[model samples]
Target: MTSIAKQIERSYSATRASAKASRLVAYGIQPASRMVDALDTHSVHWRQWQMDVVETPLLEHFPEGQRDALVYLSADSDTTITQLEPGKIYIVGAIVDRNRHKGLCQRIATEHGIPTAKLPIGEHLHMLSRKVLTTNHGDGWR
Candidate 1:
């Protein structure tokens, strides 16, 4: 991840960690004590997750043959997602730049040759603010 404003970075990290915790609880799994302990510190809460937390880039994590399974979710994408397909790995960039970095996720997806799609928010509900959704909000949609 590129260096962003410290405050935004912290907010993003906290949001992601909280989302992960929420997901674990939602699935009837108790979040580890280590994650709860880290909540009071500056560290992110990633230990409770049962899945492997790979510290590698997406390109390196997935082989070239499996690249087609990656689908990037971006608000700037022309295509809007109607339904998620099985076997596809949907990626939501956990970026909260307050509009300072518009289209950054889409650009990165393009660079990586990953297909992009936006949520069909406009077709479902009208909103006063931009259609961009927070990480937790996006997860709730699932």
Candidate 2:
């Protein structure tokens, strides 16, 4: 499960905070407004093998070069999700800026040369609104 507090948050606002909480609940996690640190190794999260994208002094979850990671489930991503790689870190960008910040994740991933993808939403649903989904919805949709 990839839910990085720092990588996804450009600025901390009440809207962002609420969206994060919703994502937490969607993942069956109780939302923590001020999660200072990542889950400990021996904590149940390690068993689940989680990682956060944002680099922070409080947490160093993923490795330096995330070659083993796959960032996906964006509204603007062109690549479609066809299969899941075993042991590959599949990270869904957590953004809730009300479309004011479009393609932010795509830009970041491209800057880092990280390949990005979106859920095969067209194949699954008739999009009435924007294709972007909250973190939890993306998590549960597949």
**The candidate that achieves the highest TM-score relative to the unseen native structure:** 1
Across 1-142, the per-residue lDDT of candidate 2 in tens digits comes to 2244432331222223443332211122333423333333113333232222233321134334655464644667788877766655555555452568888877766766667888776677777887766534433322
Where is model 1 poorest over a 10-residue stretch in terms of lDDT? 21-30
Q: Tens digit of lDDT per residue, candidate 1, span 1-142? A: 2222233234344545563332111111124433234432433543453434444556667666678888888989999989888777777564553579888999988887899999898877677887876543444332
For candidate 1, the TM-score is 0.63
Could you tell me the C-alpha RMSD of candidate 2 in Å? 10.3
lDDT of each: 0.59, 0.48
What TM-score goes with each of the models?
Answer: 0.63, 0.51
Pairs in clash, predicted candidate 2: 7-54
List RMSD in Å for every model shown: 8.1, 10.3
Q: CA lDDT of 4 in candidate 1?
A: 21
Error of 2 at 11 (Å): 21
